[model samples]
Target: MYMKLKCFICGYEVYGDPLTNTQCPRCRGILAVHYTNPVFKIDSRGKGVWRYSSLLPDVGERISLGEGLTPINNVGEIYVKNERFNPTGSYADRSSAIITSVLKVRNIDTFTILYEEDFTKSLTHYTHFVGLKPSISIPRIDLVDLDDILFFISRGIDIVFDNKPLNTLVIKYLNPLTVEGLKTIAFENYESRIPVERVVVPCETGLLALSILKGFKELKERNVDVDYEVVAVSIKNRGCQLLNNVREVKVVEVGDREVFEALREAYEKGFKTKPLSALSLYIAENIGKSLAVVTMGFKTVTSRESAVKKLILEILSQGKPMTAYEIWKTKPIYTLRAVYKAIKDMENKKEICFEIVSKGRRKIKVYRLC
Candidate 1:
C-alpha cells in the first residue's frame, strides 16, 4: 500500500490491510490517511473531489458522483460553501464515494450501517449505484426525522433492527475513510479564487470539524501557502467530547433558539440551510472574513436562466426596483414582451421579487433583485 493509516493523535502507523475503524484500538486515538509521498496539487483534468486525488486515498477505482468543488459564494462579508450541490444533496456523498469505492475494490457485497439521516441517505444512493446491498439499523425511530423515514420508504431501502449478517462491514461515522472524504472541502476552499481565512462548520460528532482542520494542517505541513482556522459550532453541549482534546479548533456552543433564528435569517437572505448549519451561518455573520460550510439547502444554487433574465438581474442589481416597462427601456434591443416574460420566469425562480408601489390612485409593480 502506498498509503498507511496513521493515528491522528499518537502518530502510530498501520500498514498492510486497511482497518475499517478510524479509532486506534491500541492508543485509543483517531486515525487519518497518511500517504508516503503526499502531494497537494489539483489535477485540472479531473472533476469534483477527484481533482485532489493526489491528496486522497489510493482507491483502485474511484466511485464518484461529482461530489465536492462546491461553489464558494460571497454573501455580504462572508463566504458560503454550499455542499447541497452534491449528487445525494448532502456533503456525506464525499464519504459515501470513498466508502463505496473501497468496498468495490475489496469485492465486498453488503454492509450494515447505523442510521444517520443525511449520511445513511447518501450512503444508500451510492450503494445502489454500486450494486451493494445495505441494511440500516436505527437506535431510535421516534428520534429520527420524518423526512429520512420517507426517503428510505420511497427508495425501498431495507430497515432491519437486529440482523448482523456475517462478514458484513458495519459502517461508522468515525471511519478514517470518512475523514479522507470530507477533508476535501478544506482543499476546495484552499483552491478557491478568493483566499479563505477561517472555516465555520456545524459539529455533531466533531468528525467534520476535525477532518477539515486536518486538511488545512496537511497543506501547511507540506509547505503549501495555506493558513486557516476551524471553528466548530455545536448545539448546547452536545458532542463536545472529541473536540475537547483538539486545541486547533475553536468550539462555539449555540442554543436551539439562536440556530432557528439563524435558519430564518438564512432563508430570508435566500440561503436556505438546516438548523445544524444555521449555527455556522450565525457565527460567520458575527465574525469577519470567514467561510460558513452549509451541508444542504432548501433549493439548488442559482444557474443561468436566460439572456434577458441575466440582463434584468444586472439592471436591478445596480439600482432600486424597476417596472418591467422601465427594464425594457434600459435594454431597448429586447422587446417589451420579452422583458415581461423574463420577469415572470425570474419571479418563478425567486431570482427577482416584486413589490407594489402606490402612485396617486394607481398601483404599479416593481421588480427587485432577491
Candidate 2:
C-alpha cells in the first residue's frame, strides 16, 4: 500500500502527511493524496464512505455522517447518482468525512475555514462529530442565502463576515483533501461494476472532474481495467487549465438555451436537478447509456433493493421473528450491507417490527412482519 501527497507539477512527494501543506514548497503547485499499489478491496462489512477506506489514507477511527453510497437511478436512458440523501444533503459530506478524520489523528483541536455554504456546513458538522471546533469566516455573509444563514445559526457555528481568516485552511479548489473525498465517486462506480462507456460530471471549478479522473487514473496505474472516460460538461468553454492537463478528459460546452430546454425535458422525464447538474443530464441523454453523476453514489444500487426485500419478506412470511443476520442467511443474492439497508427502510415505514428477545448473554433485535 503506497500513499503520498504528490505535487502534480514538480512531482514532489510527502508520504504519510496529507496536511504537510496543500501546495508544493518548491513550486507552490497543487497537491493531491496519491495512492498506488494499494490493496484496494471493497469492505462489505464497512458502512458508507468508509467502505472504500482501503483506497484512502489511513485515518485511525474515521468520523462519518453516512456520506457516500447514494442511490444511482436508471431514469430513462440516463443513470443519475443522486446525492440528496446525504447527512447534510450535499456531496460535501464526503470531503468532510476525510477532513475531520485527518484532523482527529493529527490532534488538531481548532481549525478555521473560509465558509462556502455546503462545504462549511458539512465540515462544521463532521468536526463536531469528533468534538473538534471550527470557526468559519464567510467574507460575504450578507450576500449568503437566508436559509443557509439560519442553518449556521442553528448549528451554533462561529461565523465571521467580510474578514480575513488569519492562517486558516481555505476549503477551496486548491484543497487536496477535497480531491481525496471527491474521487471516491469514481471508486464507487468501479466497485459497482456498472457498465457505461462514459461518466459525466458537472464542472464548476473542475475539482470534481479532476478528482474523479485522478481516481480512474490511479485505477489504471494499479493495472485495473477501467472502461469509461470522464466527460466534463460546462455551460461555456468554462473550465480551468487543470482540466485540460488531463489529456483524457472530454469537455462539452452547452448553450444556455439548450440547458433550459434540457431542464424542461428532464422535468417532464421526472428528473429534477439544478442547472449545473442538468448540463450533465443533457450530455448523458444525448449520448445514451451514460451515467451522469448527480451528486453522490451508494454501496449498491437500489435496483437490487426490491429483489432483496422480496427475499426478506419470504423469510419473515413464516411469522418467525428472525434477526437481520438470520434473514440475510436466507438471501441468495445481494450483500449483507444491502440487506441491512433494506430492513432499515422497512423498519422506518413500519413494514417490519423488532421482536426483542433476551438471550442467555445477548439482547437481540429480531425482525418480523408488522
Candidate 3:
C-alpha cells in the first residue's frame, strides 16, 4: 500500500511518513493523501464508512464505531446531510475512526490532538476503543466543561495547556489520514444517488470542505458524471486558509446574528445543533437545492459532578446571586440550556436557591447557593 503525500499548493509529491512529515518539504503547504492505482468499489456488507473501504487507503483491520451512513433529509427544496447522527454525535468520528485505524496498523499506540475540542472528543473515544492512548492539547481548561476534561483525564489522556508540541503522533487536520476519513462523507452522499447541485459546508479550517471536493473528484475519476459546486461558509472575520489554493470554491461570510437565527430555524425544524452546523442551513436558504452538513447536535451536560454544574455551584457557593445568562457567559463551554437544566436539577436537590431580579425593563431569574 504505497501512498503519496502531495502538496495541495505546489503539487510536489513525497513518499514519506505522513505522521511525521505533515507539511510538504518543497512548498510547506498542506498535504493530501493519494493512493497508487486507486480502486473504487462498495462493500455492501461493510459497516459505516467501511462500506466504501475500497476507495479509502489500505489501513489494515478497519476500526469503526459505526460512523457514516447518516440520513439525508429535505427541508423544502434543500437537502440536509444530518452528520450529527454520527456515533460520537459529530462527523469527526468518521475521520477519527480512520486515523485511529491507521495508527493501530502502524503499531503507533499513542497520539496527540491539537485544539478543536469536539474533534478531540471523537478521536479520544475512538482511540480509547482501539486500545490506543491519545493526549489532547487545548489553549485553556475553561474553554471546555469539567466533565469532558475529567473524562479525558480518567482515560489517562494527557491534557496539556501549552503551545509546546509533543514528540508523538499529532492528529491535526494537516494529517492526511483525517482528510482521507472525511472524504467518506462525499462517498456516502454520492451513494445516496440524489441530485446534488451544490454542497454548502461550514468552514473553519476548510479540511472537511476540501475532503468533500476530493471525494467528488474520486467519483469523477471513476467515470461518474459528478457536477456540483463547493460553497464554503465562514463566520464573519474568520478566514479559511485551507480553501485559498482550492479553485472553484465559493466562499461566503455570515455574521453571528445570522448563525443564531439559523440555529433557531434549525431547532424549529427539529434539529438542535451547534451554531457552526446551523451556518450550513443559513447558506442553504440562499442557494437553491444544496446539501448542508449539520456537523454536531447540542447536548445537555447532565452529570451532577460535571464541569458545568460544578462551576455553577462554585459561583453560587460564593453566596453571590447570578442569572442564567451570567452563568452561561461566565464559563461558556456549557450551553445556556444545559446551564438552566443544571440549575433546575440542583434546585430540585435543594442544593441551590433562586430569586427574581429586575433590571430596567427586563425581569430575570437569579440563583445562589442555599
TM-score of each: 0.78, 0.74, 0.77
Q: Output the lDDT of residue 91, model 1.
A: 91
> Which lDDT tens digits does candidate 1 get at residues 1-370?
3347888767788764453656776777778887766878889876667888888888888888888888878876899888888998899999998888888888877677778878988888888898887777777678678988887898778786644453656887777888988999988888884655799998988889989988998888889988888999988878756687788899999888888888766654545568888778888889877999998764632432266677888899887888999888987776676577668877888888999999789999998877
Q: Give the range of the ten consecutive residues with the poorest summed lDDT in model 3.
A: 298-307
List model 3 lDDT by residue over 87-150, tens digit each.
8788899888888777888888766788675688888888899788877888877888676787
Output the number of the lDDT-best candidate: 1
The per-residue C-alpha lDDT of model 2 at residue 62 equals 77
TM-score of decoy 1: 0.78
Give stretches of model 1 more than 4 Å off. 1-3, 16-19, 162-167, 298-370
- List of clashing residue pairs for candidate 1: none
Q: Which stretches of candidate 2 lie over 4 Å from their true place?
A: 1-3, 14-17, 24-29, 165-173, 237-241, 296-370
For candidate 2, lDDT tens digit of each residue in 133-190?
A: 8777777767676766787788787886668645664455357888888888998888
Error of 3 at 22 (Å): 1.9
Query: RMSD of each candidate?
Result: 8.3, 13.7, 10.8
* Model 3 ranges off by over 4 Å: 145-147, 298-370
Q: Where's the lowest-lDDT run of ten residues in candidate 1? A: 297-306
